[model samples]
Target: MIEIKEITAEETYPLRHEVMYPNHPFEYIKLPKDQEGKHFAVVNNAKNVTVVSLFFENDNAQFRKLATLESEQGKGYASKLLDFIIAYAKTKNAKKLWCNARVNKTNYYKKFGLKETHKTYTEAGIDFIILEMDLI
Candidate 1:
């Protein structure tokens, strides 16, 4: 069985390091605002965090470091986690939820009502585009 729940920033480091910044030093996965952000994990029967995301800000929430384990990809864990964060953000009265999405994942974000903006940036040789969903 899979379950979604709030998690600590410390708990997020492992997956974020493994999936998102595997090529870089593990310390590079630590975001500066981690302590001020809300972290979430999608766990399975083994209690392993299959997916992770971090939300920050008041009126505008940004989704950061959303990653799923390689073995867990295509199993819908990401979709489920995104669904949970959207609802959670709504409850917090967030007018927008956005992210700097990896270019290849733009379509996945669009499935959750996120639209890409003209802005783009590069990180660690990977291209990313800003995508936002108006929650109001």
Candidate 2:
């Protein structure tokens, strides 16, 4: 079975580094969420898991460093975790959600009611588009 909850400090920060700065290792940018933000994990009975940090302020939330082991990719873990994030954000009274969606994942985010913001851009050598959803 899989579960979702706040990301702990132990492994998430490093994993976010790997996700955002995979090529070079350097300084870690500290954020308030690092020690107090929410996270969701999908784990099996054997204890293998995938975790992601949740970021938010006011009526907005961003899903970042959504890392899953290569072995677990294509298993719908991201979507499941995203489902949890949206629900939690709603409970927190969030009115919007933003994601720097990889160009390839735009369609996926669109399925969740996100619309392209005419903000196509590239970052970290990955083609991306900014997507936003009106959650309220």
Candidate 3:
């Protein structure tokens, strides 16, 4: 079984470092106001954290540094985690939940009802498009 639960930012660093920022410095995975953001992870029956996502702010929750173990991808863990985060954001009275999704991954976010916004940006040689879901 996969268990999704809240965790400290520090606990998520390892997975984020390995899956999201492997070529960059360890600190590259760390975002500002990280402690203020609520972190969550999907732990498998083997007790390994296979997915990580961070949700921050109340009225406008933002997801960042979402990463899943390479070996564990495509098993629906990320989708499950996204489902949980959506419910969680609702509880926090968020009007919207947004993320900077990689160009290639926009379809994945679209599956969760997130629409692409006009905003665009680039980082580390990769382009990102803004995707957001209205909570109300």
Candidate 4:
């Protein structure tokens, strides 16, 4: 079963390292899970990974990292996470939502009304464009 829950700061330490190391290393977003950021993990039985989300509230709450485990990719887990975050942001009264969506996945964000706001940029060896969705 896949469950999404908020992770404590301590709980995210290892996961953060795992995500931002080797293949998917991202240092800018690595943060203590409990330090105002929300860490949502989609875990299944027997401790296999499904997905993870790391984001925080701001003038506009951002969907920072919506990551699906390598084994669980292309199964709509990312879509579900996006839907969940959109609904959660609505509850928080966010004015807008934004992400630096990977170029390959630009179409996905477009489906959710996120318009690309910037030209392509490279970060951590990945190509992406900034996309924003208006909450109001």
Highest TM-score: give the candidate number. Answer: 1
Candidate 2 stretches greater than 4 Å from native: 17-21, 26-33, 46-48
Give each model a TM-score. 0.95, 0.80, 0.94, 0.76
Worst 10 residues of 3 by lDDT: 46-55
Per-candidate local distance difference test: 0.87, 0.72, 0.86, 0.68
Candidate 3, residues 1-136, lDDT tens digits: the string is 8789888888888898998779999999887788888888888985545555556564799988888889888888888899999998888889999999999999999999999999999999999999999998
Q: Regarding lDDT, does 1 or 3 come out ahead?
A: 1
- Model 2, CA-based lDDT: 0.72
Off by over 4 Å in 4: 9-34, 46-58
lDDT of 4 by residue, 20-127 (tens): 444654455464444666666656673425334545567587766566566667877667767878888878888888887889989988998899886678887888
How does candidate 1 fare on TM-score? 0.95
**Better model by TM-score, 1 or 4?**
1
Task: Report the Cα lDDT for candidate 3.
Answer: 0.86
Q: What is the lDDT of residue 15 in candidate 4?
A: 48
Best by lDDT: 1
lDDT of 2 by residue, 27-126 (tens): 5534556665676676656443566667788778887666676667788877787888888889888899887888987898888888899888876577
